[model samples]
Target chain A: MVKITYISHAGEARLVEAASGQSAMEAAVHHNIAGIDGDCGGVIACGTCHVHVDGTWTDRLAPPGEKERDMLAYIDNARPNSRLCCQIVLGEELDGLVLHLPIAQH
Target chain B: MDIAVSDIERARSIPLDKIDVSAPDLYLRDAAHPYFARLRNEAPVHYCRESLYGPYWSVTKFNDIVEIDTNHKVFSSDASVGSFVLDDTTLNPVEGGIYLPNFLGMDPPKHDIHRQTVSPIVAPQNLANLEGLIRQRTRGVLDGLPVGVPFNWVDRVSIELTTMMLATLFDFPFDERRKLTRWSDVVTTRPGDGVVDSWEQRNQELYECAAYFQRLWAERAAAAPRPDLISMLAHSPAMRTMSPEEFLGTLALLIVGGNDTTRNSMSGGVLAHHLFPAEWSRVKADRALIPNMVSEIIRWQTPIAHMRRTALADFEFRGQHIRKGDKVVMWYLSGNRDDSVIDRPFDFVADRPRARHHLSFGFGIHRCLGNRLAELQLRILWEEVFERFSAIEVVGTPVRIPSNLVRGYADLPVVVHA
Candidate 1:
């Protein structure tokens, strides 16, 4: 399991152990973490799975996909770190990762 | 100089020409193009003058139709005006019995009130409140999909997501979730010979659910304040005193909208990717473009093809005179592909800068009440698609819907490789 942290817009820090190979969305959701909603079952169809990554991790991860990026643009509170958790696949190499949850998701 | 004859001049007061182009009963799935072009240029608002519905005006141009749909006061949605979907001789006896109330069918004060009833439930806070639960719900559906198997993605995923979401919103029993979805599909799966068979039995379906909702409302109304749709409808300012019939109408609207609209979008999103594998690659390489792609996909595949309106008063638009009480069909399938507005209107662009401007959600006072929900569902869906499936290569030819009013695929088979 990889150690994943979620930072809410209010800056509340919550840490959870996410399974290796599971998307960051699964980790936040598996731990019942607040603020990440993969509403379309990771089909990248619903924007509810939005989360922002730390600047450090944001650059390290693969950029958001065309569909993901397009969706983020429509998000009400998108940010530079804005990432759909479902798009972030967890792996052993990246044991330490952080995502910031927006205050709301439309 | 010769002027075209008014369909009314031929014989029927209501004109029979519209049947060829606007019949909701007849399937126009693979209609020839020259006829459409003629409809577009020669008679943008001319009566079909041939097929089932007869002589009803077909609004073919982009801005022209949008203008009409936006001004709901002048163009009434009352079924008395005309049922939004067309009707044709192809309809059989059983086709006459099935019924459903989509929000698109309601007009004005009633429409406004019905929409407002659940407006708060879809508010940003409400979505935020359900974030964790939604994520869990999505994960559960994904987990249930049979891996390494080529199943109907539309059934397994698209319908499944929205069905569960509807159940959660209503706080219905999870066991009965699929039932609601099935009933909803029967109501709005587009008119077809195959679908027509099942739709014949849909009234019984509605009556059955009406009883269930009646009981749920009673139980929930007695309980403490809650956030589910049932609780909201019980205490909502706009809906608290609604008659049982009106309540059922709104409930049916929510279910139909929540089910069919998003499912079409889900299937469309995948189809766009397959049709344009390069953009799919760009998405695979850089996922941030998913949102833009979603909007473009909606634009590309206008799931809800056209909404019919009845002229309340005599009005002339674009030099064409329309009579009061005339049936006017808003051809959105044509509008979305309008050349004047969207460049290369036929091609799917992943990073379209003005994707949101598309009129799929419609425009004006009666615009889509669930636009936000549809977008939310799609955003999450793309995120998931980017996560689980490496690609969605079409495995077989998709079966497009036959109804002129609903432009979508009845079945889209795709191979999903992990």
Candidate 2:
């Protein structure tokens, strides 16, 4: 199980374990994590499941694709590290990824 | 079964040219006909030849709408596809002209900038701030209805709550709030080309409304400062440089977004109580079920139905090639009812633990900014509706919007068992 930690905008940190190959959002969603809507159902349509990947682990993950980047540009909490978790399929390379969530998913 | 691609393609879009707008059973129900369900089952990405908006794909089924919503670059929400619904009027191709007066009609980057100006004000904190006012206003609106009498709840409750909320957001006089309501309806109404309130009427109202806002801005800019959304926009650095068109557009977005979506949900809630008395009893028995009840109503109503999206590039969904600039309508109303995702998609179950899963607020960056507010309004209105009158019943049939985009009611005659 790959444990993914999330620090909410209010600084509360929670942990979820993804069965390797599940997206971080899918893991968070199955456990009923707050603030991760994934309204488009793991599709990149809605930016509700956005998160900030830790800078240290940025290089480990694939860069946001053109579609993801264009979508991210419209998100409420879009930062330099912003990524739609739906776009990130969980795998072995990402063993312990830490993501920060926006105060709310718009 | 063969796909209806040929028929859909030949028409360019769903043609509503001969739509029976006045037919009782025709305009009402989830879909216009069994044809829609057939399209959903057979060709989820079927196109129709609409009287307005021209040839566009009617994305039925739950999963596909979510798919299109997820891939924004492929299914863009720019102005080209026509923002509202397909009508003889909405299809009138304007020359390099952007339709509607809000940011909902724009593409990504530009939508981002305008969305930012007022986004902060609708955040959780702000919603929390407005909760008290919302409850008071909601109660007042409900109180106005004659308890134990049967009348159109949509008119008395839904429209009232929407107008009152808009008044709170704009911090404007309640009496004039109806003007914003009227203008929003006029703007979003999808009639044939140059139909409804003529462009002359729209332009005149737009100018007057903008001038009113400008005057309010100057007064607020000079007088005692406050913390309303309008003041926030007036003092916003980004708004300071916005062109008149952008200003009008953003304001129109806020007005329409805050108004129509919530009103439909409000009416939907009442209609839900009438349609499924069992669900009503479930909530009434356990008052704590109000929150989930609000969500269920939103899901069932799908206030904002299919949003118009223009394809930015060539793409394919389920093996059908979609060329660049093709109009794609992501019908959230159909997607919210996706059977695979939501158990008993058609049933109104308040206790569905995941009651909040509905795409009523839309998805992604364009999700309803005032969703929390909309929920708050519904929550309070239901609490009051249930509290003030216990055994309410629908004495007559419910009326729905004539347009395609707003899947809600014009009126729902209900008897409040006071």
Candidate 3:
């Protein structure tokens, strides 16, 4: 299991242990994390799973793919590190990865 | 039963190339399901050579729809090229079809900006703020419903609640709220569908709608910015410079978008529970399942049947050559029932896992902006319904609206049992 930390917009940090091969979105949703809706079920179709990866851990994760980037373009208030966490598959390498939720998912 | 069997048989007997799912009568009878199911299995990327709206490509499968919707660069929604609906009349003024250009029919950069302008009204914060009032109104509406006597649920509950919400959003006068409903019906319906006598009448009613909103726009513009839609449009930098036609077009979009979709889903919920009484009992036993059940209701209703996009360039998609300027229609109603993605798609499971994952709201940039608001309305309605009525008995068959675009009902006869 890999440990993932999601800090909500209100500064509440939630930690969840996710099985390997599950995306960060699945992990957040499984743990009942409030902010990440994952409404499209990890398809990267809905931008509800948007999160800003911690700058320190950004390079440790695979970069956003073309589809993810295209979706992010339509999200409101998206920043440089904005990525759809559904595209971020959690594994041993991603352990201790931290993601910050947006003020609200558009 | 006989009609359904014949519809299925007819769907199976028709040649693959001859199937045109855009016929309004098919939807009026609610018999388009069989045809769409066949198309999904045989030709997920099927094309019809001829139809009333002209030949178009239909994307029926769930995943294929996601692909087409997300590939906005190639599949353009620009009104200039082609309107969002299969009918070219929405963009062209010929034949009594008014030319109304709004953001839903525009491409990115422009579409993005205009969408962002009105999006905040339905955003999480605004929805959170509106929840209490919505719940209160819902409770009032439900409490007023006649118990143990047949009533038109569509008129009494669905239309009333949604029209009230629309009025609230626009800050229109409460007493005159039904005008919003009238304008919404006028915007979507044709001359013969019963809403209007002719194109001239439709245009006249719409002009009155436009004039009324224009007055509101002026008043809101003169006053300070408020959270209401009119105030927002009047105050927003990007929206304030809209032309008269653009203003009317945007207003029409909001009215129809916010009104019809949720109204049908509201009625659809009762009908779904009537068809699947077991599911209703399960939900009653577990009140927590209301939210998930709301999602299932939206998927089952799929208020807007399809949204059409024009091909920006000649491209090959799913092995089919889609020529530039070709009309591509994404049948959201069909995709919502694709069994591969949704387990037991035909069944209304109140506790269906991953209920939020459905194609009722289109994917990508042009996704239904008021989705959360719609969900909130349904959720609150169901939650409040649980507090009062034990069951909403569907006493008769629903009179469905006859439109290929708006998949909805005109009347739903029901009796509330306390």
Candidate 4:
């Protein structure tokens, strides 16, 4: 199991343990975490599952692909650290990653 | 048997150049599969030099479609280039203009604001509130079906339920609900193809519809805020001051959006079960799979076959030089069958893991607003169906709608076995 923290738009941080193969978006969706809509089910579409990766952990993860970046560009409140959580596949390396959710996904 | 084999062989031998899946007659016969298959294999981004809607490019592969749908800079949904379909003809005085002022045809900040204004109607909390009403209505419609006899499922179940939902959303008179369906058909149908005698007639009918809705708008505007879509629009700052033309256009958008997508899916789901009994059996055996099954059905059916977007500027896509103001048709029907992303794209699997990941609801900012609501309606419908009927058997060949868009049945003769 891999542990990750999701900070909601409301500034509340919640930690959960997700399996190695599951994505951070899936974990949030499965647990009904606030603000991670994941409406497209992680297809790199909709861009509803956006999250701001903590500055410290940003270097640890691989950079988003062109498609993911394109979707990120359309999202509101997209920051330099913003990444679609659906694209962030959970693994042992991401065990302690932290993500912050935006106020509105639309 | 020998003749059937030869027919299949003959279908296979037809050259890719001879195949044009855009013809409505193919869909009328429910025979677009082989054409799309050949196109996907031979040319993912196939071009048709001449057709009814004139020259247009077909993007078949899954990845290519996503690339086009996401990159709105080069490829645009703006009304100036062309409306969201191949046919740019409109009865309005302005040639090659979008007849409606809906956000679906607009780009950027304008689209964002209008879409945001109406987004609350299908928000999660609102859907949760609507769950009970949808289930109740589904039960009513199912319980009233004619059992053990051939009945038009399209009319009896699909159209009835969807029209009811549309009326509720618009706060239109429930008794005159069929008018909503008629207006939706008028808005989407190609004039003089039997839906209406001519564009003049279609415009008259649409004007009648606008007059009716205008009255509703007047009533809603005077009353306090309400949850219905008309009231929502009446109360909205951005939409409240829309001109009559803009009002009619927005109404067309909401009416068609609320009508066709789910109505056709309802009929398509029944037809799918008939074509693939094994998948139906899997769904029947485990009701837990209903949610995923709903997504799979939408993907397989793809109620709306394609959405056309015109190029705003010249851009190279999938090795094709798409020039400025070119009509590019993203065949959702073709992309849903793309083998690269979806395993065994031909087969209908109820519990496919990536079920919700389909191109039916489109992608990006303009994805179907009522997607979750459509899913909820289908899920509750199946649950209620399972409790009441043993099976919904298709007794005769369904008469599919003869259109490149709205890939659905016109008359599905079905018999329920309780």
> How high is each candidate's TM-score?
0.71, 0.83, 0.96, 0.87
Per-residue lDDT of model 2, residues B1-418, tens digit only? 1224543353345443333222223345434534454566667777555433457777777767766766656666665554534432432236322334456666667677777777767766677788888888777777787877778877787787788788877888777888877766765653332224355565566667789888877777676557776787777776656776666767777877889888888777776676678988888889899987888889988887767677788887886777787777776777777777788777788777678777777765576777777777788888887788777787875656666666767778887877
CA-lDDT, candidates in order: 0.70, 0.71, 0.90, 0.82
Question: B1-418 in candidate 1: lDDT tens per residue?
Answer: 0112443242233333433555443233334223444566566776655555556777877777767865666787765455665552211123454334434566755665666666667767676676677667677777676666677878878878888888988999988798787766555543444564544355566668788899999998889869888998898776778776666666767787677778888888887888788888887778888777888888887887777778899998878788898878787777777777778877889998657657676655455657777777787777777788777777876676666655666677877777
Off by over 4 Å in 4: A6-23, A26-43, A48-83, A87-95, A98-106, B1-18, B90-98
Ranking by DockQ: 3, 2, 4, 1
lDDT of 3 by residue, B1-418 (tens): 1147888999999999999999988878899999999999999999999998889999999889998988889999998898889887754575788888899989978998898888889977888899999988998988887799999999999999999999999999999999999999989977788888988998899889999999999999999999999999999999999998899899999999999999999998999899899988898889988988998899988899999999999989899999999999999999999998988898888888888888888988889999989999999999888888788898887888989899999998998999
Pairs that collide, model 4 = none
Better TM-score candidate (1, 3): 3
> Which is the better candidate, 3 or 4, if ranked by TM-score?
3
Worst 10 residues of 2 chain B by lDDT: B17-26
Worst 10 residues of 4 chain B by lDDT: B89-98
Model 1 accuracy (lDDT, Cα): 0.70
In candidate 1, stretches whose alpha carbon ends up further than 4 angstroms from where it belongs are A1-106, B1-19, B23-37, B87-95, B98-104, B143-148, B189-192, B196-200
Output the chain A TM-score of model 4.
0.96
